[model samples]
Target: MSDIPLIHFLIVAAALFSIGLAIVVTKKNLIGILLGIELMLNAVNINLVAFSRHDPERLGGQLFALFVIVVAAAEITVALAIILRVYGQYGTVEPDKIDGLKH
Candidate 1:
């Protein structure tokens, strides 16, 4: 079986990260931004796993990726909770329209 090149993994990861960044930058809704962040995290995981493949003895990269996944899950849970609260309080999910926390 032919091995896939590291460059190929890097390119895919880069593209995923870029798309995620664009989504985060252009999105107005809090949920959209959260989705973008998740994408970016997944991209990092892809890169980590790809590099880990080279060193079969040491599983550092894969270990780190697993940690990242756990953290991302926690982050998203908290983020969604915040979003839900914001939506309930303000009646809108758009960050720009939320204006003040005092209200």
Candidate 2:
């Protein structure tokens, strides 16, 4: 298999960031926004892992990235719990429809 270039990684990261931003901006559902955030985080992880390939230390960026993954998982759990509670309080997950907390 051919080795992937740095430019290829950068291109993929940019695409992922753009898509995540678009989803976050256009999606009205709370869960959709959460998913977009997760996507962005994953894009960051890809960049980290790709760059870590060059580091002789080998544990620098990649180890931090593993911590990031754990933190992101915890964040998803908390966010999902909050979304579920909000859904139980309301009938929908649309962001604009959540007016109960506005006052």
Backbone clash numbers for all candidates listed: 0, 0
Please write out the lDDT profile of model 2 over residues 1-103, one tens digit for every residue. 5778888888898899889999999999999999999989988888888899767577677987898899999999999999998888887899899887741
CA-only RMSD, every prediction: 0.9, 1.8
Candidates in order, TM-scores: namely 0.97, 0.91
Error of 1 at 31 (Å): 0.6
Pairs of colliding residues, candidate 1: none
All candidates' lDDT scores? 0.96, 0.88
Off by over 4 Å in 1: none
Q: Which stretches in model 2 have alpha-carbon errors above 4 Å? A: none
Task: Pick the lDDT winner.
Answer: 1
lDDT of 1 by residue, 25-84 (tens): 999999999999999999999999999999989999999999999999999999999999
